[model samples]
Target: MSDALSEAIPVLLVAAPILAATLPLVFGLRFDRAGWLFTTLTTSSLFVATVVLATVVYSEGTVIHQLGGYPRAYGIELVADRLSTTIALLVTGTSAGVLAYTRLGGPRGNTFYSGYLLLVGGLLGLTFTGDVFNMFVFLEITGLATYALIASGDGPESAVAGLKYLIVGTVGASLYLLGVGLLFMATGTLNMIELAEAIPQAQGGYENTLVRAAFAFVFVGFAIKVAQWPVHAWQPDAYQHAPDGVTPLVAALVSTVSAYALARVMYTVFTVDFLTQTPYAREIVITVGAVSVVAGSTLAVIQRDVKRMLAYSSVSQFGLVVAAYGLVTETALVGAVIHLVGHGIMKAGLFIAAGVIALGYGARTVDEYAGLAARRPVVAGGMAVLLIALIGIPPSVGFVGKWYIALGAVQAEVWSVAAVIFLSTMLTLAYSARLLEKMYFTPANWLEDPHAPDADVVATDGGSGPGLTRQSDRARPDAVSIGMLSIVVVAAVLAVALGFSGDLFYDWLEPFVSEVFN
Candidate 1:
């Protein structure tokens, strides 16, 4: 125990963000600069801590820190295993990059920066938390922040979208809490490790209707949070209406992490033996995941709104993540984790890029992207690479992640699952190609005149000219900021870099995944 304490790092991972979350409320009334500075400093510090945590965990094994110096079942705990550390680093790193991008585009006008920082803090807390109730608390913090961020978007629709998300999110959280209460009642323990050990051996054969109902409720709640297929009507609206800069963050963090949490519960809290023994648990996940892939892809293909399209693509990709969890194979689960990281890089990069283009050219439809590569080669080219990666082409992170998942699907002989994934890939290519073709082949003359089509346009910073200001202005951009450009470069490089790192990273993750069975 002392040895575990000695190795503890990233222990203050939550402190930086939580402190920053409060800083805005305290000083934001006087000066916004104070809030921005606090947000930046804390988020950057959190990133550094996560990096340190990942390095230490990768080299020295897991790091476990007990919060408030309390024992299990009493205090909150943070564990920096390879998996948790990996996600922590990604979450913080992505937050830092996205926050930087949004700031460059002037997202601090509202409580955007403050809410964003708190959201980052909450997600970091959720990833590392070892206490069940602690997880729920952190989830609400993130969930509320997410609603705030979405509501802060460009128009009234954002408010509507935020309202729906808030209602549904609250309900999901309540259901999850109810399930947690049941588990606590059953075992008289709230510690996850204790519950894991104590759940299976309980009296009356353990697999009662009550326990099953609890599992169903909790899993369903998480499923909703992650935008599982039929429950996904809110995502397109949320993504479509969100500020362009923040769209990537929502797609990458909020949705992916929720799915990861569900997987964590299925494996960690209810052990595989328990879930497998529970009638229809794994099959249900597979069926729902498959339906999500198919439905989400089909919806994406018909959407003219680029943000909405990418939003649906994420739904489909995350569906694959959920399915991998349900496949009940070590390989499949590993695929899920890899895809989680890989898809985060891919989808977020594209969202930010789309935001860049939309702000620049006032183009959203597949038909309007004519000859963008000729004008802004870096942004267009970067998006092209990201879109390819999103479709799972080789020598990119997507390819590596997809390879693992496809292998897992084959191993399980889930042909319908395989078919859905495969068809979705084709649908992804079709939509992506529509964008590429518009960028490459379509003539520049086809672009709609920003002034002619819409005289009531908002001129942002990077737009037409210095004097080109409107009374009803919100944006300052005809293009993305330099900070956002920097983020795109970093994420794009990572998308390709992971292909090279695939062998080693997969090897590292393989053993950890296999441990779920033991």
Candidate 2:
């Protein structure tokens, strides 16, 4: 491809959403109808673009885009290596599924749809952008869209949660900006590649103090954005209280992209060599990751609200990915990158299932999920697949990530952390199995004794959270909507498809991870 063409790739993917967003907001002033038309067009196009871009990166290696056609060192650049494109593809593709599902089974309003499109676009922009400062701009856009989406929920709690998210989100953005400023002072360049090249040289120079301060600020700021351990106070409520349709998008994309940025900063800008040079830097990354894995999972186990449980679960998953990348080994970074993709798929599916349930019966608690399979079999089954995948069970994509991550931990002999990982896996299985048993094996006592004397199973949407409920004496919900079923099908298929594609992923990731030290 020509240089001009290559330079346009990042903007191209990002532009699809921005251009579509403005047209809908302006043209559909009164009607939300424009949201659907625009969302469909934007997400659909972005998906295709991601596929093409992924193929290009896999074939030709990293694809770099410089804004305004400036020299590599002088201009802001977007580099869609296998890493960025993989995450970008996940964000775009998952958003497409969410929008499609809501469009069909959700509240049929243009306002909601437009916000969804804007959110997806913002996330895509954040994921693909090359400049650190530009990332902050896109990050704000994403945060704003998220707050609006969450606030659109019918309940007051949704608004409150959005407000909290907004506040914390602002702090994160401010800290990120502060870090960017520090980095600029340290290297006089905002381009990631250039910073990576320039940062190491500052170790003993006049820029050394600024470099360290910048690293500290950026690292912590990204940690907050990604919801790592200490800074993760806002996640559960923000996730659980968001509108059902909006939960999955935030969980899957927001957290995943933040994790991606963390990895990029640590491995690319800070570099493995930089960590070895910088005092106590790698320690901070690995330590926080370890703490997050344990803390997030521990918190998840106690969450009765399904959405919150999954939200906490993401915190743990993301932490492990971060920790693995910090290991800085050949296969470790690959494990981290691959997990970034896997978690997005699994979490997206899980939350979508939660949303389906909430819409069905205003239910959000784990205990309330009892008999879900008997009610909405398709949604329940889809949720099962995602949960199993989350537990790292065989024949699902989740296992693929865990396998590599554990392998990395073993190779590096981080046994305590590995054991914790193992324990968390079991915890995941325990919770996953809880849902399965609830859906498939609700206790005989709670269930009406069909044969008992004068046993009356009062008909209230068959008792397990909402949607597709069947009362004892009334008609059961025949099935979940095709929109939800479609989302289920996509995630379920990928859960299995990813397993068989290990060889392909391994080959794709091998070169990228291997060349990291270079």
Candidate 3:
């Protein structure tokens, strides 16, 4: 492809969704449900665009598009490097795939899909933008759309969850903005590439209180956004209460992208040299990640609600990614990227399977899944595959990522972090095994009478006690659609298929990692 065309791809990718987002509301005037069709077409085209962008990136190298033909220092830059392109592909592809589920299982409306496309646009912008301030702007856009989507769920609890996410998400974004402000104060620039060059030359260099304080604020901000332990209070509520269709999208991409942003800021803007020279910077990052791993896994083991359990699982999974970031080795960085993509795929599939089970069998809690394998074999089988992948079983994408992470830790001789990774695997197995046993070994008790009025009502509370019941509403369908089932199966197949492609992942990522580390 020509350079000009390649550069234009990122701009079009970001603009298409944001501009298309308005069409849903406009078209809503005449058609009752034009949103899904528009969304499907838009997301499908975006995915194809990402594939072309990814092709250009991997074959030719990083593509930088300067907005309005201005220099990087003044103009907003959209970057489609190996890293960003990979993430952009995930954002687009997953957005399209989840539509398969939302088409039939819905919180459907034009407004819901407008938020959906807006969220996609925000995520793509986040992935491609090279300016810190623009990143923050995209962050807020993503957060707003997420809040609206979460609140669109069936009950008042969804609204409450959305409100909680809004408050917490706002604070997280504010902290990130404050960090950006500090960096701008220190370096007088907001472009990531410029900041990287300037931060080392700033007053007092790495030891500048401004620089260190900026890292602190930024790390903490993304920590909350990624749902790290102690600052993760808002996540379980958000995930458990979000519409089933919405949960898959948010759970898979939102925090994953946030974690990617955190990594970008760490290695690109701040650079590994800063972490190496600054006292306690690497130590603090590693510590937080390690602790979150343990805390999140322990929390997951105790949750009776399946969605909440999976929510905490994300905390643990992302902890691994964060810890790998602190390791600072090329191997570890590859592991982090691989895990980010793998986790997104696995989590999206798992949540979709959860929604399918809920729709077909009315099982939400761990105990409620008894003999699910016998009743809804396809979904149960898919969930089992995803859960096993989550546990890092060999030849699954999960294992590929964890293997690299573990190898990286061993090479770094951070035996402590290595130990945490092993322990996390065991803890993951604990929770996954619990659900697996319930699905396969336990007798089927979840078969409810079709005539019973309360048959579809499941407890919304994450097993804290008797809580608000989720009523069967127009948003939820009585049966799972083929599209939903197909998505689950496809995710399972990809989880295992991608496992064999670890070498390819490593090679594709090597150029980017080398650029950062060397």
Candidate 4:
């Protein structure tokens, strides 16, 4: 790629989706089917752009693009480094993949695709933005688009869920803004790299009241945004009540990116040196993450609703990431990034599988999964693979992340945190095994009467929002597409395939980590 092309890629990643988002709504005035095709094309193009950007990042190191002709210190900049590109790929790839599910699965219409494209743009901007204030702007954009998407479901419940998310998400954003304000007060710059330089020179070094308060507010805000335990009440409702198509996108990327942003803030902005210099900073982060791991898993194991269970599972999965961050070692941070990507793919696949099961087999709860393998072998098998991966079984994406995180914990000699990391595997299996057993070993139960009604109705409405479908619509297999199934299989394959590439990921991250840590 030429220097100019390489420089333009990051900006294009954000701009393409935003510009394309308008095309669907405008083109809809004349053609009804424009949204899906346009959105798919746009997402696919963005994916290619991300791939190119990744190659540039690998060969040339971090790619920085300053807006207009302004220099890095004063102007808005977009950065495509190893860390950002890894996440940018996940955001773009997953958004494109989920379109296969959304195409025939309802939530159709140009307006819905408008929100979809906007969400994609927001996520990309979030990944690439180089300024703290610019990050906050992208964060709000992401939150707004996400709220609208959640509310686009068919039922009143979805609206309520979206509103709840909006309110809680607003508070989190406000706190993050407040933290940014404090940092600005302490150091007159809002640029992340500049802030990193200025923070140590603040009134009290790491112990400065302004800097300490800034960290506290920023950490708390992200804890809420990432859905850590105690502050995670909004997540279950949002995931469970959003349209099936929306659930996977939100599940896979929304919180995942927020967690990524938190990592960026901690390391890129605060730096490892800050954590070492600050009193009890590492302990507080580790404790919050450790407790979230235990609490999230315990809650997940007891939930009857599969979506809600998966929602709680994210809480635990991200807890592992957060804990890894607290470990503050290169291995642990690398593990955190790997886990973030791995968990995103695994959860996306799992949710897509759950939707397939709900739509194809009318199985939404654990009990409904009895003998699922006999009825829908491919989906059942795919889901089973994802679940096993989630349990951190060897040679799976889940295991590689956990292994490094746990190893990092042991190396740090944070014995309790390490214990939580190890114990998390068993905790994950507690829920995973229940679904696995029901899917494979339990005998199929058939209705005695061919005309018997379904015990529970799973509705698939035409509108863009989420609600329980009526039994007749829920069990219709014709609505499910082969493309959707293929995406699930692909996600499962990647989860396992990426596991073997852990060392490659670690080495790719070495230069980035060294730049930050040194």
TM values, all candidates: 0.92, 0.90, 0.95, 0.96
lDDT of 1 by residue, 1-518 (tens): 24544445555777677767777777878886676677677777777767766666666777888876788876777776777777887788787777656765645553677788788878887888777777789889989999999998656778999999899888888888888887777777777777788788665435866567768888888878898889888888889888777788888899877877787778888888877787798889988898888889888888887889888888888888888888787777877888899888887888888877776666666766777788778888889988888888888888787778878888988877778778878988988888889888877763253421233444333356432332123223443678777778788889988877777877777656767778
List pairs with backbone clashes in candidate 1: 360-478, 460-475, 460-476, 460-477, 461-476, 461-477, 462-476, 462-478, 463-478
Q: Which ten residues in a row have the lowest lDDT in candidate 2?
A: 467-476
**Residue 62 lDDT, candidate 1, scale 0-100:** 71
Candidate 3's C-alpha runs over 4 A off are 446-478
Local accuracy of candidate 3 as per-residue lDDT tens digits, 1-518: 89899999999999999999999899999998899999999999999999999989878988999999999888899999999988998999999999999998898889999999999999999999999999999999999999999999877889999999999999999999999999999999999999999999999999889999999999999998998888999999999999999999999999999999999999999998998898888888889899999999999999998999999999999999999999988999999999999999999999999988777666788987887798678899999999999999978999999999999999889999999999999999999999999999998653442212245433332343323234222223455888999999999999999999999999999889999997
Backbone clashes for every candidate come to 9, 4, 0, 10
| Candidate with maximal lDDT | 3
lDDT of each: 0.78, 0.77, 0.91, 0.90
**Model 1 lDDT vs. the true structure?**
0.78
Across residues 97-181, which tens digit of lDDT does each residue of candidate 2 receive?
A: 8875576555457767768877877888788778888888888998899888888876678889889988988898889899899
State the lDDT of candidate 4 residue by residue for 284-357, as single tens digits.
99988999999999999999989999999999999999989999998899999999999999999999999888
- Full-model lDDT, candidate 3: 0.91
**How many residue pairs in model 4 have overlapping backbones?**
10
Deviation from native of the Cα of residue 60 in model 3, angstroms? 1.5
Candidate 1 ranges with C-alpha deviation above 4 Å? 1-10, 25-31, 204-206, 446-479
Ranking by TM-score: 4, 3, 1, 2
* Candidate 2 regions with alpha-carbon error over 4 angstroms: 1-3, 29-32, 203-207, 443-479
